[model samples]
Target chain A: MTVRVLLADDEHLIRGALAALLALEDDLVVVAEAATGPEALAMARAHRPDVAVLDLQMPGADGVTVATSIRDELPSCRTMIVTSHGRPGHLKRALAAGVRGFLPKTVSAQRLAELIRTVHAGNRYVDPELAAEAIAAGDSPLTAREAEVLECAADGAPVAEIARRTSLSPGTVRNYLSSAAAKLGAENRHTAVRLARSKGWV
Target chain B: MTVRVLLADDEHLIRGALAALLALEDDLVVVAEAATGPEALAMARAHRPDVAVLDLQMPGADGVTVATSIRDELPSCRTMIVTSHGRPGHLKRALAAGVRGFLPKTVSAQRLAELIRTVHAGNRYVDPELAAEAIAAGDSPLTAREAEVLECAADGAPVAEIARRTSLSPGTVRNYLSSAAAKLGAENRHTAVRLARSKGWV
Candidate 1:
């Protein structure tokens, strides 16, 4: 039986080329394509594909968040995430969101097809190197809000800007940043951001 | 005569698929492929393709740097840059490096094929929106060393680490950082980083 799949990535070149390559496989067919997380979720709702292959970073939302939504809305549609940046935190997040497959953009087309089938069969598939790195990296000590604030601070935005972006008060943002710095044993928010980034935590 | 082309992108899937798709054209032939900027330069030296299509972001160096080298070493081979992130400063840098083409990764395969031909024919092509943005963004005020220091400081690393990374003394790093901040009218190194990033200067 052929596996119907939804492919979503922000890069039009990657998405189009990947669709063409996957079409060469006899047992796999791409049902739809999307260029963002929201579009991927919308396509999933419309097509009911057997598998949803999403890029980890997209405009509207991340692949993990989309996968979580798919899990809640379309239980039968197994989701997977592919990323050129296979960060440990991203891998952990995807697995937590019940993503059936986690692989790098460097994977061969044949291997990706096989993983798609594996995922369709209700089996989990993660790149072994990525999995090992995740184990070595350990879990992040920062809470969700702390991590989010750190990510906002990654661009070196001021506390007021971060607060505006997060829709939180400036005081709250400062508190989260301080707590994150403390948890990471950092002397300041800048150091905290650097530390979290090194661990793939933010 | 058919145009010989070299494809260089770190994303294996995108490169493989792009190579496969480009092979379908009658007047185009992919002579070699590489996954890094340095490797791209090596392949260009070996294959001497008429057109070298490179990704802007790669492991060893950037496409602009590679293009500059190719222009110096193999004057006959024209170069183009394809990027998912088409920053204004990057566009300016590529153009100054004597690159013949600048395009986003979202372009259609057929359009890319045409661009390869255009670049091979000694004509230039750039995405219009990117060009507009580049023009609007204006030139970066930072010098090469200042820009380098700002990029190093971007990760929130301490001055000592930035010095080690750049092979400069800590005082020199501090001087460059301060100069960059002053030029950008930023209060501190962190704010300077944010400003430079927004301007695509680093």
Candidate 2:
């Protein structure tokens, strides 16, 4: 069976190049190209491609969010995240969101095609260097809730706004913020976000 | 006359896409593509393209270094910098380096082609938003020598080594560092470098 693929990247050149590269595979067909996360979602819904190759960063939504949306809307279609920065936290979140493959943008065209095939065949693929880095980076120190609040805070949300976004009480949000700050050895929420971001823990 | 061009960027997809875009122009031809700064220099020397479009960040040497080398090696080949980040300091440095064109990566394919033509015709091009930002950023406070010394220091070199590299006496290097630190109101050399970098002053 032919593998249908959707390519999503903010770089037009990259999207065009990936599409051109994949066109060479005998069993692969390029079905769509999207320039942003929202566009990817819309194209995915329209094309229902067998595999979605996504760059981890985009304008409207990130790769993880798009992956989650695909998993929810098109359960059979697999997702492969290709990012320039192989942040361990990103890999972890992508895995949790049920993405089937993760790779860095530095990957060669041949390897990219092979990974697409692997993911399309219902197998998982993770770049060896990125997997090793994730292992070396150790476990995430923030709990699920703590990480959630920190993500909201990282968006520059105030305590009350974070609480509203997270469906938590304002007091609970403050407690999580304080706990995250203490765990990261940060003096405040802003420093905590910066620290976590540097470690790829946020 | 047909305007020959060279495309240099670390991302293979971007290189390919830009080449494809430029191929659409009747008067423009892409003569070479490079994935690194050194590769860019080598290809420029080899192809002698009329215009060189480069990404700001690449391995080995950066866009500025590549542009400078191209100026020295192939004076007729005008250089244009296309960057994802439009930091005012980047624009300042690029202009100082005699780069003929500065653009953000968000520019459309049409605008990019037009800019290429504009630059190839021996005219200057600057992204409007970036130009506005550079205007607001005003002038860099560090003297030319001080900025040069601070750039070396940002690599974590001591004053003596910086002096050797910049062809200045050790005491002169120390005096420059002290003046820079005082001007930036930084407590130490490390803080001074950090502050200068954050402001795009160094």
Best by TM-score: 1
Candidate lDDT (C-alpha), each? 0.92, 0.86
Judging by lDDT against the true structure, name the best candidate: 1
After best superposition, candidate 1 residue A134: deviation in angstroms? 0.7
Worst 10 contiguous positions by lDDT, candidate 1 chain A? A191-200
Per-residue lDDT value at A126 in model 2: 93
Which tens-of-lDDT digit does each residue in A33-58 have in candidate 1?
Answer: 99988999999999999999999989
lDDT (C-alpha) at residue B16 in model 2: 66
Question: Relative to the unseen true structure, what is the C-alpha lDDT of residue B121 in candidate 1, on a scale of 0 to 100?
Answer: 87
In DockQ, how does model 2 score against the reference complex? 0.16
Task: Please give the TM-score that candidate 2 achieves against the real structure.
Answer: 0.71
- Per-residue lDDT over B89-197 for candidate 2, one digit per residue giving the tens place of the 0 to 100 score: 8888898888999987776777888999999999999988999988987778889888888888775566777889999999999989889889888766656877787
The structural similarity of chain B in model 1 to the true chain B, as TM-score, is 0.86
DockQ of 1: 0.63
Off by over 4 Å in 1: A143-152, A157-179, A182-187, B143-149, B158-187
Clashing pairs in 2: none
Q: Clashing pairs in model 1?
A: none
- lDDT, residue A119, candidate 2: 98
